[model samples]
Target: DASGVEAVALALVINSGVTLVKTIPLRRFEDAVRFGIGLSPVFTVFQVDDQITSSPHIAGPTGDTRLMPDPSQTVGLVASPGWALAPVDQLDQDGEPYPGCPRTFARRMLERLAGHGLELRGCYEIEFFLGHRAAPGPDEADPTPAHTGPAYGAIALADVEPFATALIRAFEEQGTGVMQFHPEYSTGQLELSVPHSVGIAAADTDLVVRHTIRAVARNHGYAVSFAPVVFAERVGNGNHLHLSLWNRNGRNLFQGGRGPEGMTREAEAFTAGVLAALPALTAITAPSVPSYQRLQPHRWSGPWACWGRENREAALRFVTGMVGSRPDAANLEVKSMDPAANPYLALGAIVAAGIDGLERELSLPDPVQDDPASIPARKRRSLGIRQLPASLTEAIAELEKSPMLREAMGDVLFDSFLATRRAERDVFEGQDPEDVVRAHRWRY
Candidate 1:
């Protein structure tokens, strides 16, 4: 207790993009880690509304799983003194890897990639709106921006600088690199980017960074929403993923090679793989009902099925980097993703899709020069461009049909994931868009 560590939080990022937690006092931390903290299997299907939904393989209160903390990544919460947090690995009753754990699924996929002498350096861009409750939304509590400054203006930065400084310091203290932190285009929206790491570590850092942001925001008396859509009419938050495929020796595979824009043959194949899976990947990257509100055409949300160099409207925006940066700076960004996605599942599924492409020696199609939506329908069709799933129902339906994803996530996990998505789809069958936006504005 010398560090005022009275309690420790054991966090499990679940399938529904919720961080389910169990806490233990510092005195029992050893016990908890040694014997795991107990929890129910029902959390696998929890909805944004906190209602319990069921999958055929997992339902009722008949089963139990344990959460084992990975102590190496445990971090002290600077904003909330007297506490620390650990991301957990879920374990079955018999102490086997829990089949439903997204982290485990991600680990298996990363391992698969590693076996092929390829790896991913990835980071999730975190974006959220800072506001206070102004009035009731169409069906839930509505919030107004805390700052009056114009979007991305110096005034906006000045208004939030004190808070931003504290956040940057907190991130540094927590061992998270702060690449850049700034006010974004949306009212009261702010974003933070961290340096990339190995795929699994990148996903872990995402959970840590998000937890830290929420804690720091509370200390500053501000509300934060990581939801995909906080308002029906306004531009919404989309947290993109920046990733690069690399060899084990740390050489960037996307630079200094024969393929278009300096991409190696393998790099081109991997990029093509991700592009091909855009339709199926949206189910994991933009999974929620409100996600559809933000995934529309002309919003720079990458609602189309294509890739481009520096094209924000392309689902996969390939960053070839500036002249001097060369090999190291090259990367690809998945733009259709948002805060509603579970970090582990999204990273894992994307890597799995890329791996599939690499194995098949897939070829990249022509990168769109302009917005795919701006392209005429006939032109889009001629260029092999198509809109990605426009709704969660379509996304999940696409997800259901992906044998690659099904195989990547074992049969049990795949079925449970689809079951949860379908269950949420039914809950939101006819809800108004604004209502959907309000419901998830703070759910994450």
Candidate 2:
């Protein structure tokens, strides 16, 4: 649904661009015509590579080639003679401002953070499912093993050795650091952690890693999904975003051994901002109907708006490694996000919200030592702890009310996204659960 919304938004922008920009030179058409008559329509997609390539047919029977950007060029061919001449790297479809372009939008938020003389860095740990590419029957059980080994077992290599080996190679080639891959609790589910990097590279590595996993898996006749739920009974997958902030002089902002919760004032404020914005950010972080199923309490998915040390049950987890561990290992792990989220949007929103907190000097609540899920209703209310969006419709409603997000993502793209998502919700909200799973479970 998010993908379709993106597509529709891009199409609208491209159409606007094509209308405003002058037509291609007549000579270019002549050149394309020379390729052959009855050939699929042809158009020159001026690419960053400084080359022009023509396709006889823009897309074959399958829409794969049509949606794929040219290998040598960054432009995607969406329709015959219609190409995405401008790379939507961080821009919108219309060559105008697009707040929805996660890359561009994240950079904007990062710049805002910089205005306060602070810097941010991030790392993403992705959990996913891998198994036979074939679809399973309704009553059929998935034959794939729960994992290659016990939880975090290095010895369970046999189950995912082939897949892991290829994943490692692809990550290396893509210039991404592969920290590790281990069997997770879910059947055939695996988690891969990447060495964290500063600023944009951290997000870039994540996007590349997702591409690498899918490509490597496809080559091996396996399908990999980053979906939150691949099966009802199994643990769902999640995309946990780990982040830390620092000052212009490179001081770790989240650390102040003598300060509140060992967090510096600035770090505390930033964390407060993110916590306050958590509900609204869910539209971009989780953003799917099925994602809510994974955010249930007691499932270890952070649903409550609170933070704690080494607490997996809290939305904002303050990870403290061993006594001898590097202090930088102390960072916030947001466990509410899922693979369905566009990394750019999620990162941007997190950064923006955190910046908001710092600018406003927001105060954070005391850490929840016991189970946040089991906290008394009165205590939870007193502390202002709230739950994340429980469904796509609710998530979108939250998103629609976010003035911060609307400002970060341009008015046009945001408006388009809202419209498209509302249309989709109208179509899919009340459908059969099994059919809903079948229709969208693997799409992301």
Tally clashing residue pairs in candidate 2: 3
Candidate 1 segments whose C-alpha is farther than 4 A from its true place: 1-4, 134-141
Off by over 4 Å in 2: 1-100, 135-156
For candidate 2, give the lDDT of residue 192. Answer: 94
By TM-score, how accurate is candidate 1? Answer: 0.96
User: Tens-digit lDDT track for model 1 on 131-176?
Assistant: 7765555554578786655877889999888789889999887677
The 0-to-1 C-alpha lDDT of every candidate, in the order given, reads 0.86, 0.63
Model 1, residue 440: what's the lDDT?
A: 74
Per-residue error at 421 for model 2, in Å? 3.2
Top-TM-score candidate index = 1
Model 2 lDDT at residue 313 = 83
Model 1, C-alpha of 372: deviation from truth (Å): 1.1
Query: Model 2, residue 102: displacement in angstroms?
Result: 2.5
